[model samples]
Structure formats: C-alpha cells, structure tokens
Target: MANPIKIIGASLSQNVRKPLAVAHHLGLDVESVMAAPGDDTIKAANPSGRIPAMDDNGFHLSESVAIMIYLAGKAGNALYPEDVQTRALVNQWLFWDVAHWTPAYQPIQFERAIKPMLDMGDPDETVVAAALAKFEREATLLNAALDGKDWLGGGEPTLADFAAGAGLTYAAPMELPLDDYPNIKAWNGRVMGLEGFKKTAQGQ
Candidate 1:
C-alpha cells in the first residue's frame, strides 16, 4: 500500500478542508498536520507561505484547488471527471471560487470571525459592509447557476461542489445572510450531506 499523503494545514481552514474532503471522498489515505499559513512547515512546502500544501510521497504541492484536483485525478474519481467538456465545467466553478467567491467572502470572514478571535480588535463595519455587498452579488450569480441543478458540474457532486462550498464554511459564524439565496442554501445542504464533508466536519 502507498504511504498516506501528508496534508499540511489546520483542519478548520477552508482551504485545508478542500483537499482533506477530496482525499476522504476519493478514499485516499492522508495524514493531516495542523499548521497555519506563514508557519515554517508550510513555508518549506509552499514558498508563498500558504496553508494546505501537500506532500504526496515526498512530492510537494501548493494551492488548495490544485491539491483537490490532483487528489481526485490520482484516485480516478468521477469528481474530477475525464471528459474535456465536463472537466472544463468543473474547472470553471473551481476557478470562480478562487478568483471571485473567495475574494468576496474572505473579507467578511476575516473581519467578523478572524479579527475577534485573534484579538485584532472589533470588525470594521465598513469593511464588512463592502464585503457583504460583493458577496451578495456573487451569491446571486451562484444561486442562479444552481437554480435547476443539484450540483454545479452535473448530477453527482464534483470538485466544483467541494471547492465552492468551502467558501461558506464559516457562513453561520460570519453571519452570512443566506436566506435570500434559497438555491444556494439548498445546494449547500446537499454538499454538506456528503460523507467526505461530514468526515471533515468532525475534525473541525
């Protein structure tokens, strides 16, 4: 049997949870190490000092989205898919999460959650309001995308679900108002119901 892949990052992190959920869903053996971004452990594997780096049998890799795709591909899972068109669709949501969804939601998360937790003073309501505005715009797009579909890529949950869903890991804590986006709320429930997500949630 192959050695367990080392997944380096705190389990609670949304980025870390991305690959961890993929690993679990793909039935890949993985060992989670709790390290935060900028830590020396993470620095060795990712020059950018990012969390959620990977050491698969000594092959180091960075970036959460890349790690999730690699794990799914390595396991020959349907989550990553093989068809070009299907893969392209999945990639679209993955990239969207990194480029759009995350950017919109992260500021709200940092301000409402991370700031207070780290004794960084109270949240700047101005920052929160601006982020919420951006998040609402993005959520409208996502809600529309999920209007008739259960999953982003197709019928079965794919990397798209995992990648995009991670952005809402702190939705409640951050007080994200999801009531306005019923489609997203329903889809989120489905995504959270997956065994991989359930397993990862236990650690968090």
Candidate 2:
C-alpha cells in the first residue's frame, strides 16, 4: 500500500531486520536491497554508508529505528499507540535499545560473525566478556519488565518489544541462558512467533 517500500540492508543484519520485521508485521509488500557496508550502490543510497536505509514512496529514511517508526506510522498506530504516555514509554525503550543494547551485543555479533568473514576476527576476550556481562544485566532488567505481562507494554506487543527483540536477535543462535529469566524467555518466544520476526530472520 505504501508503494512497496524499499529496504536497503542485509537480511542478517539486526538493524536491518528491525524494519524488515516491522513491515512483515504490517503485512505490507516490500522490496529488499540486501545492501552491506562494502556495497558501492548502498553507499550511494546512504552517504554515511550504512545498511538498512529505506525508500518509502520516495520519502527516504535511514537509521533502523527511524525507518521502523515511519513504517509503523504508515501501517497505522497499533504498533505505536495513540496514548501520549504509552507512546513516551515506547520511545524510552527504543532509545534504550539503541543506546544500551545495540552497543552491547552488536560488537559481539560483529566479532563473532562479520569479523571472521573479513579475516579480522581477532578480538579482545576481555571486551567480549564485558559486553556479555552488560547484556546479561540488561536482560535481567527486561526480565523484570516482563514479569507477568503478556507483552512489553501490556497485553499486545508494541514497538518496545520490537526494538528490544531486534537487539537481542544476535543472542538467539548463541543459546544464551534465557531460561534463568522465564519471563524474558517467554517474551523472546512470543517475539519470534510474530510474522515480522520470523520473516526478518528469514525463517519459515
């Protein structure tokens, strides 16, 4: 309905997956570019040369979360919400994902996956250990938030769930000890059950 929005980023990129997942959740038609940092064409689309840029009916947007929010608005406000306070809370989690979660897990993912591909896999174990520790701490906080709620905000999952889950995708394959936090483990399963989540992960 929104002119088959274009998503520029690799399927495996967590940031890229954010908007991809959101689009799938909205049941919107889309075209993916599968761009990466080394791609010249993608560099042209985004001068700063980041993956996960988007072109929505000629309205171009970059930054993963921004693209997700734009698509969410187009998909209608269900994923966002009209309530001012709730919207603010969603924004808070989104900010937390970018500021805290991304910085923590992204580096580890890069070190484990991308770096090896580039033959730059030499990583400082101390740094990886610290990042993982921080991730665990934050995950505990997320577990607390999910204590008895069916979703992050309330009954229905919201952008907060999407945002948090996107950052945590890198941890899934690693089989992080999520069982310790039953609530968070359940939340992860719920997120993975979403069409958007599954599609972005390129899963059946």
Candidate 3:
C-alpha cells in the first residue's frame, strides 16, 4: 500500500490548515506532523524554513498554495478545477488572498494573538490600527466581491474559498472588525460549515 501524504506543521497554523481542509474535503489519506518554522523538519521540506510543507512519499513540496493545488490535482477534485477559466478564477482569489488579504490581516493576528500567546510582549496598538485600516480597504473589495456570491470562485466551494477562509480561522480570537462587513460575515458562516473546515477546526 502507498503511504499517506505527510503534512509538516502545527494544525493551528492557517497555512497548515489550508491543505488539511482540502485533503479532508477530498477524502485523501494524510498525516499531520506538528512543527514550527525554523525546525529541522521544516528546513528539509522548505529551504526558506517555513511551516506547512508537504512530503508525499519522498517528494517534498512547500508553500500552502502550491500544496493545495497538488492535493486537488491528486484527488482529481473540482476544488482546484480542470476548466481553464474556472481555475483561473480560483487562482485569482488565491493570489489576492496571499498578496492583499493576508498582508493586512496577519499583522493583526501576530500582534493580537501570537505575541500574547508567545509572551512576546504587548501588541503595538499603532501597528494594529494601521493594519486594521489596510484590512478595511482590502475587505471592502472582498465584501463587494462576495455581495451576491456564497463562495469566492463560483456557486460551489473551491480552493479560493479554502484559501481565503483559512485566513479567518482566528477572526473571533483576533477580534477582527468584521461586524461591519455583513457580506463577509455571511460568507464566512458558509465556509465554516463545510465538513472539511469543521474537522480541521477540531484538529482532526
């Protein structure tokens, strides 16, 4: 029998959960190994020393987005899609999430959550305020995009949803100012309701 795919990283990490949710959604056999960035295991899989790397048999891969595409392709699932145009749409949101959304929100996460948890020190309110401002700008675009859509890509959930939604895993804990974005709040509810997301949330 073939070995299950190994995902190296902590489950609490949003990047780690991205592929885990997709794998669970596709019913793929996978194992999660908890490790943080800069660990030897992480370095072996990712030269940049990042968490959430992948080892399929002896094939090593890095980057959450790349790993997600690989898993979706391996499963022959529609999450990543085979249609060129549809896949492009998914790619669009995936790139946007990484470039725009993540940059804006991650600072808030690091300040409000990671710092406090790691005893790094009090959050820099100035930094938090700046990030929140940037977040509102990017979120306006996201909110508008989600106005009539349940998912980011199309009617059904796709890698776009998984990627974008994973970033919000700590929304409540981080106290993100999401109350104003009714559209985003509603869409998030749908994303959170997926079986794969639910299982990943429980660290299954």
TM-score to true structure, per model: 0.95, 0.89, 0.96
Model 2 agreement with the true structure over 49-149: per-residue lDDT tens digits = 78878876777788888988888888565789889998898898899888887787776777665566568857666767877798788888888888889
Q: After TM-score superposition, what is the CA distance of residue 111 in candidate 2 from its true location, in Å?
A: 2.8
Task: Point out where model 1 deviates above 4 Å.
Answer: 202-204
Deviation in Å, model 2, residue 88 alpha carbon = 0.6
Worst 10 residues of 1 by lDDT: 195-204
Best by TM-score: 3
Q: Candidate 1, TM-score vs. the true structure?
A: 0.95
Model 1, residue 71: displacement in angstroms?
A: 0.2
lDDT of each: 0.89, 0.79, 0.90
- What is the per-residue lDDT of model 3 for residues 1-204, given as tens digits with 9 covering 90 to 100? 879999999777899999998888999999888888889988888888897899999899999999999999895677987889998999999999889989999999999988887899999989999999999998899999999888888789999999999989999868997889999999999988998899898435
Regions of candidate 2 where Cα sits further than 4 Å from its true position: 1-3, 115-124
Model 3: lDDT to the true structure:
0.90
Task: State which candidate, 1 or 3, has the greater TM-score.
Answer: 3
Among residues 3 or more apart in sequence or in different chains, the pairs in candidate 2 whose N, CA or C atoms overlap within 3 Å are: none
